[model samples]
Target chain A: MIVIDTWLYGELASYAGEDAQPGFAQLKIELPDGATMQDLLDEIDLPTELRGITFINGNLSAMPGKQHDLTQELKDQDRVALFHLRSMWPYQYRQGAAMLDSFNDEIQKDGDRGIHHAFNG
Target chain B: MWFLRINMKDRTHQLTEVPEKYKKLAGRSLTSNLIADEVPPLAHPLGPNNKLVFSPGFVTGTSAPSSSRISVGGKSPLTGGIKESNAGTPWAWKLGRMRIKALIVEGQPEDKGEFWGLVIGLDKETGQPTLEWFDATEFTGQDAYDVYPMVFKKFEGRRVSVCGIGMASEHAYGNAGVIFEDMSQNPSRFAGRGGLGSVMGSKGLKFILLDDAGAPGVEIADKELFDEGRKKLAAALNEHAITKPKGGLNTYGTAVLVNILNEAGGLPTRNFSRGRFENAAKIAGEAIFDGVKERLGEERYNHACSPGCIIRCSNTWYRKDKSEHVSCVEYESDWAFGANLEIDDLDTISELVKLCNGYGLDTIETGVTLGVAMEAGVLPFGDGEAAIEMVHKMGKGEPIGRILGSGTGTAGKILGVVRTPAVKGQGMPAYEPRAVKGIGITYATSTMGADHTAGYTIAPEILAVMDDLDPLSKEGKIALSRAFQATTAFIDTSGHCLFIAFAILDIASGYQGMIDEVNGVLGTKWTADDILELGTEVLRVERKFNEAAGIGKQADRIPEFMHTEPLPPHNVVFEIDEETLDKVYGEL
Candidate 1:
C-alpha cells in the first residue's frame, strides 16, 4: 500500500474536509513471485517526466532499473515514496532532454544496477 | 530651469536648465526612460559610465492626496539589467512642494578623491540652482539629522530635500540603497533597489540636495474642475471599508494580509517549497501589533507610507525587549524572511529588516536571496542570525556577500542551488504564482522582473469585482492579466498609491474621476482611454527592450516543478498553457 499527502493553497483548502486530515487513500498491489520496481510504475498513473533521485527514509538510493528488483520482495506493509518533479522552477514540466541525459549517468553512478540485483536474486 | 551639475572628478559644480522634453516624464517613467536612453546596456553597473537619477512623479507637485512617489534608476548590479524602483515617503511630498520635478547627478571626477557630498539650493526669488560641496568625512556613521542639517544650513531655511547614502553605499556594495529624509526628519524612507547607490557612488556623489525656496507652486489649469474630481475620489476612498479611517489596514497595516493569505494556504514557506508554515501565527499582524503595544506603550502602531496617504498600511515594529526594530515591516518582507526562510521569529525578521534598511537594499530581494542561499545549503534554512550576518557582510563588500547581495539569481548560480525560484533574474514576492494563476501571468510577463506589484490580476480574478471567475480556471486570464498590467502601469506612472486600486475598482467612477483630476492639474484633457493607452505604451517599450536584450520569448516561463508537482490541498497544477502565455505578448 502507498499513501500520498496533498496540501492545497488559498480557498482551495475549503474543498477538503474542515478537520484538515490527510484525506488518506491507498493502492493495493499483487506482484508475480519476482516482480520489479519498473513494473510498479507501469501500473500507476504518475506523470511521465517524474524521475531521478528517489529517497527511501530520507536517504537517496540507486536507479529505478536496479530498484525495480524490489517489486518481488514488496509486501502489503511496505512503503514507497516518489518525487514527481526534479527541477524546482514552477509552471512548466518535462525535464529538458539535456537534464535527463546527465541524470542517467548519475543514476548509474548511484548503483541502480545493484538495487536491481537485490530484487533479481 | 535651474539644474546643478557636479563634476565629480574635481569636486566642482555648475548650474543648468531642465530640458523641455524631460519636463513631461517624472518619477519611475522619467528615471527609467532616462536610464534606457543614456546608459549602454553592456556598461558595468558600478562603473563611472552609469548615471544615477532621482525624480518625482507627474502629479507629485500637485496638492493631490498621496501623489508623492520618488523613483530611483540606474544599471542594476542585481539583475545586470536596467532597474527602476520607486518608494513612497513624505520626502517626495516635501521635495515636490519645492517645484523640483527631477534631480540628475552625473559623471565621476578626475582625481579618485575621498568621499564628498553636494548640496544644491534655490536662489529664493530667481529659483536658480546653487551647489555647495561638503567635507568627505563629516557624514560618516551619522543619521539624517546630524548630516542633513549641516547641508540644509548652507541653504538657510530654504526648505530643502536631502538625498544621501550611508556607509553601506560608500563601499559601493551591489545591494546598497540611497536614503531620502522625509518631512518628519526620519531617514527611514529609501529609494531602495537596483543598487542605485552604486550609481551615486560611481558618480562620486554622496548626496544631491534640492532647495525650492523661490519656486512657484505647481500650476493647475482649473481649480473648480480639479477640486470636484478630487473630492469625489477622496470620498470614494474615505468611505470604503478598506481605505477609510481606522480600517483593517489602519489597525494592522499590510501585516493584515499575513493571516488572510495563510488561511488561504498560499503563504509560502521553506524557501517556496511548501504552501503553509506553522509559524504564521507567531509573526502575524495581531501578534506583531500586540508585541509593539506591550513593548512601546504607544497607540501609534500604524504610519502612512507617504504623506497624504489615507490608507495607513504601514507600521513601526518594536522588539519585545523594547528596542526599535524597523519601521514598516510590510507583509511581503514578513513572508520572505520569516516564513520563506523557515524562521518564525518576528524579532529576527525585524533585525533582518533593519539590516537591509541601514545597508540600503530591497527587503524582498535581499530576503529572497538569503532564502535561495539556504536552499543551496550555503547556510542552513531558518538560520536568522546567519542571515543577518550575511547582510552585514554585504555592507562590507565581502566576496560571498557580494554574490548574495547581487540578488537571488546570482546567488543560486554561485551556490549551485537547483531550487532557484525566480523569474527573469529577479526574485518573486510572497505569493506562490502557481497558487495564484493570474498573478503567475504577471510574474512571467512583467518587464521589471518577477515583481508581483508589476501587474496585479488578483483583484479581478480572486476578489471578483466585475466578474466572479474561478481562480483555478485558465479562461479569461490572459485578458485579465493584460488589463490589470496596463492599469497598474498607469497607476504607477500617475504616482498614486496602488492600494487605492482596491477602492477604485470597487467604486464605479472612482478610478476615472481620479484620472480626470490629474488631467485638470496637468491642463490636459484626458479620459480613461488615454490612461489605458499610456499603460499599453509603457508595456510595449518594456517588451521591445527585453526582446532587444535577448531575454524575450524563451525567458517568459514558470519553473518545471509547478507542472509536475500537483500542489497539495488542491490537486491542481498550473493549468495555464504555455501557448496562452505567449499570446499575452501577441499584441505587444
Candidate 2:
C-alpha cells in the first residue's frame, strides 16, 4: 500500500473531514499501489470541479476548467495539494514553471498558447 | 492645466501653463519622460541635480472606475536608475481634479536637516494652484501613522489628502517608501519601491497636503464617449468572476495568490532557498479571510483602497480582541515577512506590515533584507520576535538597523551572505525567479529593478496575434515578456489600477473601454496598436536613461545565486540565456 500526503486549502479544507483546520487540512491516506489521481479523489470524496489549482509533488497538474490529471497516476509518499476555485496564478507568474507532461501538452495545443487568466474547458 | 514646480532650495514655487509636449502625457508616461528630459542621468540620486516628479493618470478624477493612481518618478537611490513608483490613493484623484498636469520638486535645501511642508490649494480667482510652505521640522523623526492624523487635523474642515515620508526616509534609507493616506486616513498606501521616498527626504520635503475643495473637476473632451467607456469597464469589473462583487479579490484580497504560488512551487521561501513554504496556507489570503471571520465573529469583505475602486481588494486584519491590527497585509508584504522568514502567525505578519508602514520602509525590501540577515546568522529564521525587534531598531536608526536599511544588496554584502536575491540592487518580490522563468526574465530586464508588476499579463487575443509565438520557447517567452511590459506601461499611464488588467484581459469590451476612456479625455484617436507603441516609447526613454546612468544591458541579468543555486520543489534554476534576456529590450 502507498500512503499519499494530501493537502486541501481554503474552503476545500472541509473536504478533509475531522482533520480539517481553519484554513487548510493535511492528511495521509493509505491507498493501493498504482492508484491514479481519480482514485485518490474518489477516496477523499472531493468533487473534481471543486478543485481549481492542483499540484502533484509540487508540479502543477491542473487549473480551473482544465483538469487533465484525473488519469495521471499517483506514487507512494507523493505530495498532493488542491486549492479552491477563487485562487489564481496569473499567466505571467507561471509562464515557464514546472507542470505535468499531460498538462503542458494541453496548454501547448491551446490557441493562445495557454496565456490566459483562467481556462474554461 | 498647469505644471507646478516647487524649488526646495529657496522654498519658492512656480505654476506655468502645461507645455504642449506634456499635455498628452500623464502618470508614468509624464513622470518618466519628464525625468528623462530634465534630470541628469549621472547625478547622484540624492544630489541637487536629481528631481522628483508626480503626475496623475488620464481619467483619474473622472467617473472612471478604479482610476485613482499617482505616478512618482525620480532617479532611484537604491538602483541608481530611473524609477516610477505608483500608488492608488485619493491624493491622485485630488491632484487630477485640481487640473495640475505635474508637480515637480527640484533642487535641495542647503541645510538638508530641516524639512518643510507644502500645502497646495486652488486659487479661487485665478483657478490656478497655490502653494504655501511651512516649517515641518517638528513632524520629522516620528512614525507616519502618528503624523497622518495630525496633518489631516491641521487642514480640518477642507477636502484634503496627505502624502509624507517616515523615519526610514528621514534617515535616507535605501528601502524607504513614500506613504500615502488610505481611505481610513491611515498611512498604509504607498508608492513603495525603488527608494523614491528617500529622494523626497533628500530634497528636504516632509509632506505634501492637497486641498482640492472648490476646484474644477477633470476635463473630459467628450462626455458621452467617456460615459460609454466608463460604463463598459464598470460592467466588465462587475461581471467578471474574479473581479465581481464578493469575488476572489473582494473576498480575500491580493493575498489570495499565496497558496496558488505556493502550490505551483513559485513562492520564494527562507531567502529564496526553496520555492514552497510549509506554512504557506496559514499566511495566505484565504487564511486572512477565515482568520478575520473567526476573530470578528462575522464574515467581512474587503474595502476599496481609493475612492472609486469597484474591485476593492484591500483587507484588514483584526486582533484577538476584535480591534483592527492593520488595514492591510498585501501579498508581497505578507510573504516577505511570513513565508520568507518562516513565520506562520498572521498577527506577527500584520505587526511587521504595520511597522513598515509606520516607519515608511518598503516591505519587500525590508523583508528580503531580513532574509539576507537571517542567512548571515544575524538572527535565526522563524524568530518573529527578533524580526520585530530588528524592524524597531531600523525605525530608530541604530547602526545595525541602518545596515539593514541599506536594502537587500547592501545588506548581503555587509553581512557576507553570497546568495542575495537582488537584481539592480533592489530585492526581489514574492515570486521566485528560478521557479518562474518568464518572471525571471522580467525581473532581470525590467527598467525598474525586480518588479512583478513590470510585466503583467494582458489580453490573450492581443498576444495570439503576435506572429504565432509559442510561449514555451525562449524567443517566444522573450517576445511575450516584452509585450507584457509594454502593455503594463500603457495601463500604468491610464490612471487605472493595474488590477484592471485582470478583467480587461479577459473581457474584450473592458479592454476597449480603457482605450476609449483615454481617447475621450485626451481627444486623440488612439487604437490598441497605439497603446502598445506608446508603451514601447516609454520603455525606450527609461532604457536610454538607465544606460546613461551606467546600468546597461550588462546590468540586466539575474543575480549569480539565482542562476547557480537551484530552488527546491521544482529544483530549477533560471535557464534563460543572456542573448534571450537582451532580446526583451533589444528588439524594442
**Best-fitting candidate, measured by DockQ?**
2
lDDT of 2: 0.91
DockQ of 2: 0.77
DockQ for every model comes to 0.02, 0.77
Q: Candidate 1 on B265-350: residue-level lDDT in tens? A: 46667887776676675776656765676677765547676777777777778766676667778888888898889988888988
Docking class of 1: incorrect
Per-candidate TM-scores read 0.77, 0.98
Lowest-sum lDDT 10-residue window in model 1 chain B: B457-466
Q: For each candidate, what is the lDDT? A: 0.62, 0.91
lDDT of 2 by residue, A1-121 (tens): 9999999988899888888876789989889999988989999998999888899987889988899999988899999988888777788889888899889999888777777667879
Off by over 4 Å in 2: none
- Each candidate's interface RMSD, rounded to one decimal? 18.1, 1.1
Candidate 2's displacement at residue B303, Å, is 0.8
